[model samples]
Target chain A: MSRREAPLNRVVMALSLVATATWLALPLASVAPNRIVPGTAHTATDLLGWPLALLACLPLVALMALSRRLDRVRCHLALALVLLLLMALPGWLAIASQWLVDPELPQARLGIGAAWWLSLFWLSLMLIELRSRLALVGWRAALLPVVVATAWWLQGAWLGSLALGQELDGRRGDFLEAVVDHLLLVGGAVGASLVLGALIALAMRQSPRVERLGFAVLNFLQTIPSLALFGLLLAPLAWLAARFDWLSAIGVSGIGWAPAFLALLGYSLLPMVRNTHVALSEVDPGVLEAARGMGMGRGQVFRQVRLPLALPVVIEGVRITTVQAIGLTAVAALIGAGGLGSFIFQGLGQAAMDLVLLGALPILAMALVADALLGALARRLDHRRLASPGGAP
Target chain B: MSGRQVNAWAAPLLWLSLLLLLALGGDWLEPLLRWSEPDARRVLYPQADLLTLLVRHVQVVAIASGLAVVIGVGAAILVTRPGGRDFLPLVAQFASMGQTFPPVAVLALAVPVLGFGTWPIIVALLLYGLLPIVRNTLAGLEGVDPAVQEAARGMGMGGAQRLWQVELPLAAPVILAGIRTSVTVNIATAALGATVGASNLGAPIIAGIVNNNTAYILQGALMIGLLALVVDSVFARLLPARQ
Candidate 1:
């Protein structure tokens, strides 16, 4: 807080510019016969490339000029423009894939090359910088353009004919179903873990033996590979379902969501339990004493004092657990649970990278959103904690 | 575990047994899993060599976790320095960003560029493993008592000497906790490798998924589960025993 100490925003700004410049001159797409075939690299200058690319960089140029100061609504505008332009680039490549094929090269496949993905990374970072520069206050402001852009993309404007879109169209129903299943699986697992993990933490707080035994079990459970956990559950679940008619009647089969759900629940427990324990333990003892001095009973003190104080950390645990669960559930597809991992394994089997992206991108977006929303909430909670009734802000 | 005095040799002995199992237990264990085919014949895994797969799995986890530790701890040390203090959030966010993409996704993306097999999985595991080590390293170093550090400084130690002789030793256990986490997580996540053609313990699971054979799944899952348990226990005992 003493001073800026150093000013290197310009360096980052310059690096962004340099990377984009490099990207513009490089091949952004490759036209191939199929997923595995090596496609010839097609550069940006080939079709509407330089002009479009330059327009995209206009905001970045403005950013570099005002690098010494982090302000400029125009720069934010330009970054959004750049993002839109970059998104369109892929569409154009998709179009070009259809139109630009040689007479002999039938079934031309258009796929993003190294430069395309790299530029996406760079522009995403630049977009972050612009958001920070604009002082956009929360996830809402940051998400506005992204939501708009994603909505626009969903219209099947240019990306529709792309290999990825075509795959989505083919299995539109299945894809939509998978999306719903993925959300439900994550929601259920995280929700259950929050309750179970907290109860475990509470037990740990009441007894040292419980704490010791709980962490050991949770850690061991966590370390088990996701697939292994699912696999391990198979025989027992099948046996239980067979031995008891009611269990089978309730749909506790060996595969699908049953094992997947249980595995994710187990995977999410360690973070949930660990965070709850640490948060509960770290509450200042003096605060508890003060509550007691004010005539609060043990239960009252815990409900009001301890729980409120520990809420932020508990939420943090939820955030980590949710994000981690989102990832782990993708692997749950192997057990016939049929989430995003189904698309991934299929894509891998088909040697179709775009199909993989189709599955992976949504999972990535989900995790990011979960992390962002919960992270912002945690920060707000900490800020509120600072402004607690008796605390100095 | 918190209150009991751990026998120093307990973990090592457990690991020795696990290693012996990994080396020799597969043939004996094969008979436990009986897969029924359409012809009504029972069999073992169609294409699995348990020892080979376990070794490959260990190799991938070791390399990936090692890289993650070096980078995570190195970045933590750098950012905690006066000159690098401002970068703490940036580095932390960057590492976090790497994790939001699932390891399976990373493998899928990496395969096209890095080619098939071990390299892609290693890259994916490295990315997946980075955040825990970095975060824990930050926690460990920051948790070092300031007054004790000041005392060390008062003894006329330079910055490097102070960090190496004082800060690091004090932070060692916590940093090890981070490595333990990164390693364990990567071991689990590295199973994504089998999906991408990197032969490992997941190979059987993937094959089982393909063939609808629970026996193959068990063979793979059992080995990985046991492997994870053994590795995890070693990490559990990493903290200095107090007896």
Candidate 2:
């Protein structure tokens, strides 16, 4: 680390320390503020024991002392790190409470709400940082937040909160569990939809007739409303129950995950199929001809030439499918999928904002994580031909 | 194998076959293939003919998708102008905000002021569809060949004429493709219109869920899905093959 890096790292260290302390303190603070020692409770927990807060001010303080400290990257690093710490403050407070207070009491669970708020706070700050960086640097950085917030809010409004108001609540645990549930539902559904969609797209590629059928099927899937699709799946699913004992045994109960997952899967197919077909079709004509000239059959040409070249576009389709599926999965909650959407509906019923927030936060985080992780994968795949040392045959 | 004969015969024949299969053998297929169930609510609605539903949904989806295309394309275009590049990302940011905010939330937020039905659904659909439209339009227009544009200008066409006659026509296929995407997405999203009281196909779906009638649910779902497929295929047929 350079001279600037040192201060930046120190400030970051201080922030981390403060955040850790605060998160540990929140549950305890919620319960027995007095029992945890006077200074240790709030004073010691005041953002990494006061020194860190002062440390937070150090970069700005140093900027005044040294004219050269105004470098752009340095300023950005300082700002981003400090904001990251500030965002982490609530969790730190929650953690501190947990460490200092009694665990068995109901009040001690303030950590739950605190942790929730902190993560949200962190997300908000990251968003702001992302926006500012976009303003300062360029637009590509803006992609993550845009995709994330869209996925998040779409889920919050549609699934997690059912267009209900958001507020602070103790139901964060339930919301977290619901979020995990959504990930499982959305992850599985989208994963399968992508596979099925790719297969259909691939099948369409096999012949003009198949292509036309794929086109028709995909179109049909795209036109139907999500809520309607869920409804459609129910009857067929129920029919399966009538025909098969196992299906009846495992069929939707009052309302549950199956309807939601199936609906999401159906909704995702259009984009996945269309994008795959277009991508595969667009695989350089010359490349296909070259493969054929080399005596490679259709299957070999597709596998060796077309599919690999089309992977990036197919991935793009999957990216859209995944993001859209996350949003649709929230609607699945209407069918009793029991994800964050459950709270959204409950909040709508009760007219409470906090319940909505408890549910919405996790969905937002999931979108962010998914976008980040998958986006990284997509970018990596984009450069696949270059990564392989030898030139294409 | 002739291209003209293929196009002439294939389109109508396919539609006839699909319709005939769906209508005549539907009862038998119901028991055998068992694709979906009959909807009692659809019977109650009285105005369930394919044309009426199509026209109504087209109005809803068109207004929504139209607004999305204009705003999305406008923003995309505006940002590329001089002194506008910095704000290009901002446009994407805002559009993403529009998207992530959820159409339902937009509906909820709009309903207080916009007050139920068509307008609210339109606004929600517009916002929901903006991202794809704007992104694709920008990509399409920007993707145009500079040499063609330079030649257009070199031939004495002014910026406006160049854009209208040359650039736009060249970008038409891609931009229209984006429009097609927006339309399809809006068609599906318009289903949520039922929540705020905009009449579309969502009514039967919601009703099916409320009543625990699998047939009803399947009816609504299958119809919507089929509608989407038909519309998508139509759009695909309309699109000129990519150069």
Which DockQ-derived CAPRI band holds candidate 1? acceptable
Error of 1 at A359 (Å): 0.9
Cα lDDT tens digits for candidate 2, B55-103: 5666887788777887888888777665456456556665665566555
Model 1 alpha-carbon miss at residue A198, Å: 3.3
Instruction: Encode model 1's per-residue lDDT on A268-296: one tens digit a residue.
Output: 99999999999999989888888888888
TM-score of each: 0.84, 0.63
Residue A26 displacement (Å), model 1: 4.0
Cα-based lDDT for every prediction: 0.77, 0.60
Per model, the share of native interface contacts recovered reads: 0.59, 0.41
Span of 10 residues, lowest total lDDT, candidate 2 chain A: A157-166
Per-residue CA lDDT of model 2 for A305-386, tens digit only, reads: 7767778778877777776776677677777778766765565455443354455555655655565556656766777755
